[model samples]
Target chain A: MGELRLMKGNEVLAEAAIRCGCDGYFGYPITPQSEVMETLMARQPWEETGMVVLQAESEVAAINMIYGAAATGKKVMTSSSSPGISLMSEGISYIAGSELPCLIINVQRGGPGLGTIQPSQADYFQAVKGGGHGDYKLIVLAPSSVQEMNDFVDLAFELAFKYRNPAMILTDGAIGQMMEKVELADFKPRWTNDELIEKCGSWATTGKPAGRKPNIITSLEMDSAKMEANNKRFQEKYRKMEEEEPRYEALMCDDAEYVIVAFGTSSRVCQKAIELARAKGVKVGLLRPITLYPFPKKAIAELSCRIKGFLSVEMSAGQMIEDIKLSVFEGGCIVPVKFFGRLGGIIPSPGEVVKALEENFLKG
Target chain B: MDIKDIIKPENLVYKKSELLIDTIMHYCPGCSHGVVHKILSEVIDEMGIQEKTIGIAPVGCAVFAYNYIDIDWQEAAHGRAPAVATGVVRLNPDNIVFAYQGDGDLASIGTAEIIHACNRGENIVVIFINNGIYGMTGGQMAPTTLVGQVTSTTPAGRNVDLNGYPMKITELIAQLPGTSYVTRQSVQTAAAVRKCKRSIKKAFQNVIDKKGTSFVEVVSTCNAGWKMTPVGANKWMEENMFPFYPLGDMKDSDKKEVSNN
Candidate 1:
């Protein structure tokens, strides 16, 4: 245990990563996420922990650096915001297609272009869906507070290695800059790179000489048959991931008729709405998804079987609602999956969410 | 294990076949990349680092260097090999790491990476091939293209009026404190090829010694772009390229001769 100290969310993540024994960090300075690199550079872990930190030329170069380091079976990471992340999409697909394990953090801002630098959960689809080309999914962890930001960095790396795929810590600008008291573990490296390579070297890109042919580390296999085999290997791994990685938390859902579902920063607001609605004799409950990709379908469906209707709330313009509809009705039930929210950086207050619930879930 | 055994003509040393790739070479017949690749393979064989060396190729005519070299490789976007190599080598310092780049890829596009890697004193070998022309893009002017020399982009004979003069990359990098070895050698003549091999080998050896940033800037020929025969191009590089780019070791702190004059 360490002394309780207040820190920004992104700072907490950078500190946790160093403590976790991340060997490489390549990132370009971008707002909201700039602190991640600044703290890492000032810390100069290169001399002490053999941690290498580089300010990459661009987001594209940064992610590719992660790809290269990851090929050596190192726990490497990179962080960026909206436009910067959009640039990393192509590399993300390549890393995923290569089946490399790494962590990427996106402190999401409003988007489509140079969207506002304010907080927004509009990237929900981008985080869960393959934000890049090809078939892939990032194990997206949404952090609502500084504590979760600290906690999720370790969790993201754990899940990344466990599934042999990329994991994303998807938060918003508020979570990145806002301060909160955090209790972090004293320094201890979880595992060395040799340990990671020993477990993953069969597919790694470490060079082999005359007696052994050189290893080819590429996502491009012009041969359709070979490409299909690679896809199959990833598919089986993803199936195993789906079986084990779904996570969510429900509040006051035991005796409710209407369920309000949300996640990340929006989930906090939705929980407040659920409490306020119940205080007024309105039966309401909240379902918060900790893992956005493995969208808690089974649990939501079981609850759907009991509730009258499901009200979807979020900070995005109806992005997570689509997944909510699929999860709520996957069990063959016909409950209406209603939606409500704002777009870009605008967030609906709990009062506004309660009103939407009354109009959509309660009155109906 | 011997150099001759590794570089046998019939063995397809660096690859399963030949450096004469079937990928429709984007380079002219006399472009020095073919020669550079042949010698690089020979060096890899001699040092016994083919198994340990990871070659990161930059975007240029040599984009397919990975295909020709018989070792592990990952293709990097323009000017990014130094950064990418940094990632790989930092993770596995025991493994040999190198970057292959042309003037355009290393000097213009990746200048930041090349300079920073050297400044940070990263232990890696960088082979910088300076042919004075963007050979891949059909004889376009390059950062290393000499003043008063003509190319596609500088058709008016690289006048000092509009077009800037050549960039002395090796000379500039030698100024950085992180560099332990930097040489401006050439492969123009048979005699020079022997010297070039020694220069490239020393660069790689410095990396093995944990010495920071070893750079070899080879003043190469681009006969296809120069519109000259192979023999004439070699002579032209001797007369024209050598004067502006110069030849020999620029800086090597461990050995004698402080500068490559």
Candidate 2:
């Protein structure tokens, strides 16, 4: 256990980055996540941890900066809201194509356009299903609490470097702005250039040493055959991730009649809904996915065999539910997966989730 | 000595820069990119920073610059070289970083990146190549294309109202206080090539001195894109491109002190 402090999700993210040995942070301000940069600037991590914090001109430049720094085998990241991440699509695609390791935190607000600054999980599809162009997938981690926000920063960087792919924390505004007690991690020193050269010299764009040819960082494969081969290679990595990285929390799932599948802040609401449903003598459980990209497909598929049905509770009309339905039904098992949710930054309540269960699964 | 003995190792007077890879250049004949690439390689070799230098290749004719220059390279998305260079220099301050960008990749779509990176006074070099038309993309009009210049996009010679005026981006960079040195040079003649090489060496030295952004714009020619022979293109560039984008240093922070004194 490290120091415990009451902090907002955004603020803890900044502190955790410093403690996790982050080399640099380049981000532009957007609602619900601006405090990420604000907190870094106030903490002056440059004076303490030697972290480079810069307020970029726009989300596009910020993400590109991550691409550049990540190429040098540095632990760097950026945070943004929905519309801001949308502007970063081009840079994100380039980063993915180059196979550079970096972290991106999307404390998602309402979207479609510059929708709202309130909490929403509408970006589930964008995060999991390649928000940027090209055949690539980000290792998506969804944190339900401020503690997870701190913990996931380190985990995100670890997974990013482990696979040499971009990783994202697909959180929402509620978790970003809400204050809670967090036990921070112990400080880890940023890797020196010598250490980085030792580790990632084979691929990283560190300067070319005497014996080696120059290391080129680029995503453009002009040859069609080569591009297809690269795509196939990425697909294999994603499959391996699915095998090794799917993470979820199954609460009261044993011998349950129906399961409530949710993630992020929606999972917190579903926890309450599980309590509410149980009070009414309903055997309901909660299945909260922690890794959204390497989704708990196998878990959901197994649950489909035992549970009567599933109710996906989310802050969006229907985004993650599609993945749930596909995962459960892939084996031709008709487990009766249904969706119940709000939209445009509206937080679905526990009562609403319980009502959805009673009306859809419990009755008749 | 006999003629065969005269061809001995000691008698060798000139050789291509060791930094240039033996790969056959893909640039079109008479294109100024090969000339600029040769000069840059020679400069890097002369500075003995081949092991420490990192170059950002642009998206136009010189997109394959990495194939020619035997140095660590990052292929930036069209127009994002400066931002990419910023990422490199900020993290590795000791490394010599520079972006080799064409006019379309710098002045148009990537205008924000170049301006912001300059304004931030990033300790890096920007090698801007302003050919009046896009070469790799089938001769399209570029941001630096002169008025009355005909291109694939401008079927009937460029009109100011329709196409806008040619941008003097180096001049714009010179105005920014963050820039320590700004110059526009050409590689058309032997004398011009020597001057351009000197300018590039100064830019690299500026990086070592931590003297902020140093921009060297090489006003160049695209003979294939211009529908002309190599000699014709050079003549046209000398006559038209030189007047709009004049040669010589526009801003030098070091020179300011001597002149002031």
lDDT of each residue in A59-171, candidate 1, tens digit only: 87788789888877788999999888898897788789867789999998887799898888888888899899788888888888898888888888889888879999999
TM-score of chain A of 1: 0.96
Best by DockQ: 2
Q: What does candidate 2 score on TM?
A: 0.98
Find the candidate with the highest lDDT and give its number.
2
The alpha-carbon deviation from the true structure for residue B76 of candidate 2, after best TM-score superposition, in angstroms, is 0.8
Question: How high is the CA lDDT of each candidate model?
Answer: 0.83, 0.92
DockQ of 2: 0.81
* Alpha-carbon shift of residue B139 in model 1 (angstroms): 7.2
DockQ of each two-chain model: 0.46, 0.81
* lDDT (Cα, 0-100) at B21 in candidate 2: 96
